[model samples]
Target: MSNYPINPSTIAAPHSQSPLGANISSASLTTEQEFETGIRIIRDAYRKKIATKDAEIDALYKDLRRRDAEIQ
Candidate 1:
């Protein structure tokens, strides 16, 4: 499970108008983009981890079956 919150409530509100409104908007956009990238990276990592675990489980099961066959 991801520790990162994907909830909308956790997202920061885009900056409101100010003297640096343009700069703030640009920065906010960058931050949001980075956040999305981070999520993708984390998600991919988890997928790889799951795949590796699944492969390990399958190998173990195969080994168990082989052992059973030998016993018979």
Candidate 2:
């Protein structure tokens, strides 16, 4: 509300947008970049692991078919 003074110190911070006070500090930007890099690394590792699992599944299916044919 316009009647409330924007208090930055209070732990009960209101999620209100202020044109004058909404400035990102250098430290905050650095921290955000680091977070993004960490997220990217984790995502890439997960994707590689999934691809490896898919390849293993394909190999297993092929082997199963070969064994089935030998039994027939």
Candidate 3:
């Protein structure tokens, strides 16, 4: 046998035509736009969540310092 590996597609049975095959080109643009929009929304939400958490931690830290000074 030759050293070259056999291609699986050549040996595999034919698959039924996919529904998305014809519309893939057109669908890809819309899919990409949606994907980008989703990413932007997720990033914005994540940033907001982190900022809120940081603010909460800062407030708690300030309270702890004040309590410590009162005790002393």
Instruction: Please give the CA lDDT of all the candidate structures.
Output: 0.72, 0.69, 0.71
Model 3 lowest lDDT segment of ten: 15-24
Q: Which is superior by lDDT, 2 or 3?
A: 3
| Candidate of highest lDDT | 1
Off by over 4 Å in 2: 1-29
Q: TM-score: which candidate is best?
A: 1
Displacement of the residue 8 alpha carbon in candidate 2, Å? 28
Please report the TM-score between candidate 3 and the true structure: 0.57
lDDT for model 2 comes to 0.69
Give the lDDT of residue 4 in candidate 2: 82
Per-residue lDDT over 1-72 for candidate 3, one digit per residue giving the tens place of the 0 to 100 score:
999999977784554333433434543345455566667778999999999999999999999999999999
lDDT by residue for model 2 over 1-72, one digit each (tens)? 599887867754354433322343433344456566567778999999999999999999999999999999
Question: Ten-residue segment with the worst summed lDDT in candidate 1?
Answer: 16-25
lDDT score of residue 32 within candidate 1: 56
Order of quality (lDDT): 1, 3, 2
TM-score of every model versus the real structure: 0.58, 0.56, 0.57
After superposition, the stretches of candidate 3 with alpha carbons farther than 4 Å from their true spots are: 1-29
lDDT of 3 at 24: 44
**Tens-digit per-residue lDDT, 1-72, candidate 1:** 999779987776666433333434454455556566667778999999999999999999999999999999
Candidate 1 TM-score over all chains jointly = 0.58
